[model samples]
Target chain A: MASKTQSKTTAEFADDPINASLTADDKIELLRKMVRIRRFEQTSLKHYHAGSIGGFLHLYIGQESVAVGSISLLGDHDHVITAYRDHGHALAVGMTMDECMAEVFGKKTGCSKGKGGSMHYFAPDKNYWGGHGIVGGQTPLGAGLAFGVKYLGQKGCCLCYLGDGAINQGAFHEALNLAALWDLPVIFIIENNGYSMGTSQVRSSAHPEEGLAARAQGYNMDWAQIDGVSVYEIRAGVNKAVLRAHEESRPTLLEIKTYRHKGHSVADANAEKYRTKEEIQEHMAEHDPIDFWKSTLIGEGVITEDDYKQINKEAGAEADAAAEFAIKSPFPDESEIFDDIYWEVDNNTEAGRTGRHFFHG
Target chain B: MPREITYREALREGLDEELAHDDNVVIIGEEVAEYNGAYKVTEGLWKKWGDKRVIDAPISEAGFIGMGIGASMLGIRPVMELMFYSFAYVAFDQMMNNAATCRYMSGGLINVPIVVRGPANGGTNVGATHSHTPENIFANMPGLKVVSPSDPYDVKGLIKSSIRDNDPVYFMESTVLYGMAGEVPSNDELDEGELIVPIGKAKVKREGADISLIAHGRAVVSSLAAADILAEKYNINAEVLDLRSIRPLDEQAIMETVRKTHRAVYVEENKPFCGIGAQVSSMIMEQAFDDLDAPVLRITSADAPAFYSPPIEKLQLPTPEEIVERSLTIC
Candidate 1:
């Protein structure tokens, strides 16, 4: 089976050295990550329906390659942040599946200790800033993360991801201007999944025929658009932006075209109302990032059909075990509610002890 | 002897000391670098430390403030200056949601050691848009710490403490009181150490037993004036208390003052509805209800958006006359 040709927009940077440097095992690992993320989302959604997991579940089913490909290129100083559809990024950045599943389950053993629900996962140690919920809220934060990197004199960058809907937010524009003017080492990755919740990109955003990344032109920053379905293409394009950020302390706006098979969230039952079932099916069948990568690896002889099946089996088992762990984990104790609200209050410092930190106490 | 400095100078001194104290502390905001500052509270520091230390951001409050919050999570202490605290509404979501909840949401894995400081009083006659006193609003949030200093001494000390705090501190100042001079500990007198007025503490501006006049920010100045009037004209002694920190409120100090005076009057520039006074009034009633001689009365700004006209705006905020009258009723 032949892999699809690289999109013309990303053709200039298609031959990224980072892709060439990946060994057979590393390439197979990327496939495994994508598979794991897919299985995780599927399992989480199952529990969501079964009433074990509560709140909204923004499944990152079809967009696994975007997180796995881009995050695999990050170095020690590099950081990543994304909007609510963040399980892929969280898993890609080395968060345990158990912790990620438990976080969504709202259990005490969760990454955020059951404080942040599905929309807010954070691993500062991994340089994964958060799972921000607001549309364009993380844009400024992404730039700020880069600002911290520059201030500390570290040669690293921050990858800030947002959806097509967030493009229209004033905060994103302001962040772009600041990132450009200050020469902050940050990459604004627009995960263009066509629709902003229910509204399609065409209805929610305004852009030239050059596409949404062209808005970067207004900020006097470099921009590119890429086919997000291919992990090879995502790495090829994102690697250039990362290199530019490291070497020149510059910012780039890279719009990666992708799709979500599920609705905005499990709560967004009207996902089928705005777009047709046929469009979703077409994307799932033809352009599924996981399936596309799986065939590409097979064609390249990196992994045989049997190896792919083994990998899928392992990923499925891991995801199922994570769900079991989440279900068994107890909810946070009632007394623990007052904890973690303020660093001072939790640490029992003079500032914390001096005042009434909690009203109830 | 302590030297007298304007409130603006006191704030600038605090920022300068912190910048010199820590390599991680940086000042960021619109016109905060080259143009001195919107209120000149950050004056001369830009030239002293250079651009990297003192950054001049675009006039996007949400962008810069949120950026500051992001930077703080990574160990950089950002002292963000909002031109007017009123403009905080422009970045309300960022301030209220992101900065306030980052610690709790991340389950204490991340700490936002950022300070957002600016004028937040309504008497400048900058109209309703510019003259918002939102100390009560920001104080209402749990994760955030709110500080509004009245005099130069408290401003200098509290600014330092707020910067050093490991949480998001909203330092509300007064444009009208920026030039007002009060005695501050001079640099030469700091042979002992740096002056740091701890957050969540109240200070007694004047001591008395007849009645207690409690306030924060510029209202403390008005309360002091009313206290003088109470002593000279009414032959009644009034104790004046300044709540330097609003959120981690000095409940002990408030209860003590209420217990001492038996009659108390809450004075503030914040609007009457859901204002700081309302919270204090409730606390007083709950803790010291039996000790109270009269119902705790509140003297707040008129329950409306600040008036644009100078005279009307002056009347819109709590005046010494109103404080005195309100105190007389309680006393």
Candidate 2:
């Protein structure tokens, strides 16, 4: 109850104007974060079109609010691991956009020190385990991390994020069973973008499932569904889930219902063929978390339209600057190729010595 | 300094010694605690160490194996037993991606000091599904130390060393040799602490001049038998080298023997193609080409799956007679 009250009331400050619990600076910070993700995604799409970014590039456009809301609820000490659609997640976790952009550009300045490209990005110093490319790969790893925290007698839990497609994997079941069996402190987030690659949920499933959290029933886990588009909803949902996991030392699965505006990747030939334009328009009107946040913040007098515009402008400039830095950065040297493939062996003394040592023991 | 004991008893003693020494050490697997382990390698451990350690895990390999990795990640040294070696394939994903590579993936953030022990190779009437010699698979994987001890002495020393080492070790116990008796050094008998057989080192079982014979796991015992036959009948004193660990192969020891002996013969229980023998042979050619007096020879199982028929199985596998004949021809 103490944790629930702490998390739920923490967000009321931004929700209620009379209470004024959230400071003006906090509101500005939130706006800046959302704007940063928005600008980064837009510019990244341009880079993708220009063939600067190859491989599978899944833009975090409509789902920006989820990262903003959930990451806002987390502290610097908290750990996070996520699926391949991870640029926004990394930025929210406090990695510089230039490093992330360069990582996407496969430049040496990337967050992974340029070894791991966009998908496999890992920044352990910042408590980000990785940007795992495999769908359900992060669940067991996240659970193991939480187990480590608990065993070491630490005060942190791991927030493991995956996609709607990943819940069907065997690793998800194995991870959840172990997490529940051990009562590990972990927050499992399923960002349900309503499609597994090009196939719709209806096509993938035999029985129509309402939310990703429903599958948690198979493992007898604590679960809930939320409107992921709304930053307020995501914040409230994650805050509750995270606190519950930490306090009870139990794993909680939060299924955030959101939609991706673009196709699964850049190579979708007939993106519009899968779904009707009417369905897209309907979601845009009913469930645009960005639009909802703007109206709520404005209506509550938390910020003005001019403030929003200035934040957007600043974010755009920052994204442009990051792209410029990434493009100008030098490619990795050839000498680096042989290094870091494995742990370097230090045998400098033996290097100069040619003959064998003859000793009688 | 040596007392006779079975391989199974030696393994049990190893677990007992580790638990007695380290408070962080724990044992988990199917029937490992209450039922005295599937192979009974952990007999009486539960009574001695209590239930907190020496846990009896459920029938979930992935779950318990992942738990072992999780526990190891937090400084708990867990020695997990997969009842049968063939079943390890179920937990291969966790073993390979998580337990094996966690330290490297985490930028050497921590070490995984976990030992997965089980009985491998087929001598029992168990079907093809239940019987598989997967030493090559574990040997092929990086970030893992694979050790297969042939006798009680090596078993006790290697198991103790694996528990103390700061790497994930896979100890494949041969079921065929579990009942076989051999001398193991006692605690009071040893002047120092427990004997630690270094990883990636080979032991020379017998010395000879004509040809060198390389083997590992249970095949080491088989090779010794073959070497004696060659010495008695063929008048060929074949040098026998027992490769204890396969991953960081005792290449130096192997090369030294091959170069001196002038002829080499590799013996293994598994099939010949792409086997550990192939790796050893290629390395010998690469490094000791000038010293070789004759072509390298290999004695291994045929390119066919092992079946129930003992007569057929005998024909399929390389025996002492075959080894002596091969040694004479090569010499």
Candidate 3:
């Protein structure tokens, strides 16, 4: 079983050796990435309301640190895959805001050529597999990515992120068993954001006190809990799992206590009804990851309030430009609908010409 | 001369040849590696390839199937097996939503070069839960390629083509036909590409001018037997067209057969409503309506769950008698 102990708060967390090794520039870059994600998500919500970006917009507003911190520690062989709430991970792994926003806008220049909307960003060249849409669907894929890394004799791990609600899914549990049974190099990051859609964690899951990661004990895999409010703590905690994967080819379950300020998606009309406004406001006021990190940087004399404002402004401008670029980009042509359905058909190989690959043609 | 081999041996030979052909190819499923396959189709593969190439997974279809799709995205060609095709419902989301759509959804950036193979047939007294023919269900999806080979020759060639095709191919086999023997190319002939059957190409198993019997998988065997009975008893010459691939359907072959015979009878082990025969019947009516001399009739399994009683179960699936009776009406 997972330990029932509470996660250490940012203030309670001791000096992070990983943070200590980071140069002043590296620390600022982490802060910048978080702010960039925040601004990108906020802009997406604004456009979503204005009827520009269609489909579900699962914002990564409050959980930016988890993606930025963990992804920053990834080596060349390391890979990343996540569920629908994936804008942060996409941007963290070097996917440009223009391509991502274009994808959300359903433009041809988008990362997925506008075929996959907000929930399906992919950059295989960068080792970012996808932004899978189904709940608990990407968990098995994550384990498979690790299996590929191990099979190819690569020295790295895969960081598969899922929500607290997904931990209850049968696929996720099955993936955990396979990862442990095979000793694959993967870290299942459960971003426990207090609520799954309308239901709170206590109502949706069992053993809330023991934490979701405790279920890792059932698989005989290592488990831990981390304070998601601190980027330093997230990096330190995930770094340990990455080392275990690289050196031992083992799996770990890390339950990062995080919070989401917005609704499950921009269209979740009952976001306020299910959870009290006070609860949302309280978390925003005290446990906001961005504010906590910004203040910590200021206290350390690495950055001032003026520098934070400048960074925020730049992120906002960059997001605005991306949205503008998405607006200007063209949608894919009608002929393109049948293009990517098969590799053989797309490349016009000898086998491609033999059959009626498309129904209409 | 090509050597005779059972359907099981042909599949094993195909897998072995592919594993030897490419280092990235692997086999993963429950009982696949150590247990030598639930049906013994993978006998001695574990010893030949060792554990790295042949892996055993728990009875977790969604986990391992989705894992194969993921690995395929990273340049690994994984051939995953389901102990029974009826168990595909457990991993339908992964197969339909992920493996089928990964390439299209990824804008052609990722290719899910994975083959999901298993026996899909009824009439074995395994009850309803274990018997299901989902070729039509999978063929309905746009991005998926559905193959249901009837004989050992087609099975060996199609399995190889499916593995190398760079798409998600759902290869539906038959447990009843696993032991059936048919002529297959020798290993030396295979090396020179003698038995490499292409996808979406139908074969004229037997030629006649009176009627056409269109079928796939085990039903092809039934149809061929019916053609003999039709010629011997009723003096009706029937053309048997084996529709080896369902999704990328060989419309040209179907039309040619229809044009030659001017009458058609579709047969399959699948149920009738919205089945593969239904699609073919609709296509003939739409494209070759003038070529037809009579309405195209269909003979299929009884529209109910597979019966557990061995005697009744034998009558539940399509048989040669059913095919001959249905063909007589169309003729």
Off by over 4 Å in 3: A1-14, B190-194
Model 1 chain B: worst 10 consecutive residues (lDDT sum) = B185-194
TM-score of each: 0.98, 0.87, 0.97
Q: What is the DockQ of each candidate?
A: 0.85, 0.27, 0.78
Cα interface RMSD of each candidate: 0.8, 6.0, 0.9
* Top-down lDDT ranking: 3, 1, 2
RMSD of 1: 1.7
Q: Can you tell me which runs of candidate 2 are displaced by over 4 Å?
A: A1-22, A75-78, A206-210, A281-286, A334-361, B16-26, B50-52, B67-78, B98-114, B160-167, B187-192
Q: lDDT of model 3 at residue B104?
A: 78
Clashes of each: 0, 0, 1
lDDT of 1 by residue, B49-75 (tens): 998899988889999998998889889
Say which candidate scores most in DockQ. 1
Window of ten residues with lowest summed lDDT in model 2 chain B: B102-111
**Candidate 2 docking band:** acceptable
lDDT of each prediction vs. the true structure? 0.91, 0.76, 0.91
Q: After the best TM-score superposition of candidate 2, give how far the Cα of residue A350 lies from its true spot, in angstroms.
A: 13
Model 2, position A71: C-alpha lDDT score: 77
